[model samples]
Target: ESTGRPLVILDLALTRDVDETVRALPGVVHLDLPGVRDAVPDAEVRQVDAARAIIDAEADDFERTLAGRSMDSLITALRSHIGRVVMEEIERLRPLQSRLPASAVPSVDGRADARVVAGGGVIRANGSSGAIAVSVAAPETTSEAAAKVSSEAADEPVITLAQAERALHHLAARLLHQPTVMARRAGQEGREDAYRQALELVLGPDSVGGTHD
Candidate 1:
């Protein structure tokens, strides 16, 4: 996508003094690039690099205080939040999975090895707004894996579990953005029945995405 530039992203999570945790984050964030960015090659990359330099300078602001909360509570909250995030995401994506062929999403090894995470993380899940802190434990290595995934995806699109889950969350936020719009004025029973049937098409048994199916 970048004519071969490896890009890195930063996500910021913070905790405040009070009930800020109860409010759910709204939809995605979008960045608009001027027409010149497309007209002039690499304009987007230049701008992004400058923006990243400013963020790197303020890295300390991204740190959080874990004072008062017990390690157990923090871990528990993390597990709970991650679980719900994944579960809701699966529900959201079941429909998409049903429509797309398995070949449409190749595994990491290029042989359907399912463990490969998505090749890109540009569109990612922002951690729960209410959570105190977000932590990740991973090997101190990524280059080898990144190179492999990138090479494979260049030939055919490859998807990872994390990528799939993130896509679901992204889709759910867009689909459910307007709850009021879901209200219908037609024959209520018939319309509602039709809606449920449509839902079943994507999520019902024997759906294409289901492993067993």
Candidate 2:
């Protein structure tokens, strides 16, 4: 429910364009101006209260929808929404090509960047700083081979075995966020099944169903 009263200061700003269009209509009240506040009577205060209640209820619904959802899920949802909005804006601005200079258009390269996968127990240099480290363990044999190879690799900064282990932990945390680690935590069959169910609910079926024990 909406009370026709602005529930937030930002709402007032958003209504400015709509208010201009309303003012253009023949018999519409010109409540767009700041002076219009002076005309609000004591009875109109009820409208503000109604609007506040509506806004609060909407906020509650938003909180509930986001509850227990991972940060990644929230980020993905927001990015998807923003991508749609950006596409719409680009389409809207397409007709104004003449007004917008050719130079004003932003340039973009459509190439897909290569993704480097980190396997566990494989030592490699940090891409950003060229610091040596290991990926999370891939397989037992592969991990052992990687550790041995890393140990023999010359001219690399010497990170001790203990330091390398710590780096693996950090790398794991970086690549797999808390929700994934929590879902994989060791437990008996019943508890593990419960965790799997909870994970399916949170991360969706694709994340939980495809993995084999």
Candidate 3:
């Protein structure tokens, strides 16, 4: 079985070069050194080691060349050195899609239908057609949660069932943190009718603010 770790490769010469380049570019971090070395095989490690050795030798020769050079020469050399360092540390990771575990991925069917805004109540998936049935009650503490419960209770209510359903959908969009499938059933125009029917079934005719049974 695969360990699920991504394979990474580091090239010291490339890392140094990237490091220097990044200093000039700004806002970029070179990861060719530790990052890649920690993830790749021994062959790549040997190549990185060789590149570092070459860079050190080149630095010595360049220093000698600057012995009699002017300030401009020194600055140019400094810039090049920084750029080389930045690039040398750049590493890459190769990801294997087939190696990924299925359990690690999310399921598409686990989505909701609509959410109640007041209490974060969400209509159950596939329940929006016949009656507005919720998969779960709205959250008790959330403003939307509270609103949903209160709206259902208040006589001469300011919030209508249709409006509540819309609010639920909006709340779901905001906080349910899941995609909602709109319920489609015969004779149902929107979420309100569905919810009303669900409430009537659950709460009965004597229940306050429920649809007539």
**TM-score, ranked from best to worst:** 2, 1, 3
Tens-place lDDT digits, model 3, residues 1-213: 545554333346743654345534434334566665587999887998999999999997676444323223222333344344334322110121112233222223333332232234333333335244444442355444444444542321122234434544454344322111111221123343454345346534332232223
* Segments in model 3 whose C-alpha atoms lie over 4 Å from true places: 1-36, 70-213
Q: What is the TM-score of each candidate against the true structure?
A: 0.22, 0.27, 0.17
Query: lDDT rank, highest first?
Result: 2, 1, 3
Query: Which of the predicted structures, 1 or 3, would earn the higher TM-score when compared with the native?
Result: 1
**Candidate 2: where is the Cα deviation over 4 Å?**
1-47, 58-122, 126-154, 178-213
Best by TM-score: 2
lDDT against the true structure, each candidate? 0.39, 0.44, 0.38
How well is each residue in 9-127 modelled by candidate 1, as lDDT tens digits? 22232323223332332332222233234556587789889999989866633331212121223223333444566697566545434443454445555332232332222222223
Clashes of 3: 43
- Per-residue lDDT for 24 in model 2? 58
Q: Evaluated with lDDT, which candidate comes out highest?
A: 2
In angstroms, the error of model 3 at 70 is 7.3
Over 34-72, each residue of candidate 2 has an lDDT whose tens digit, in order, gives 546666886797899899999999997666444433233
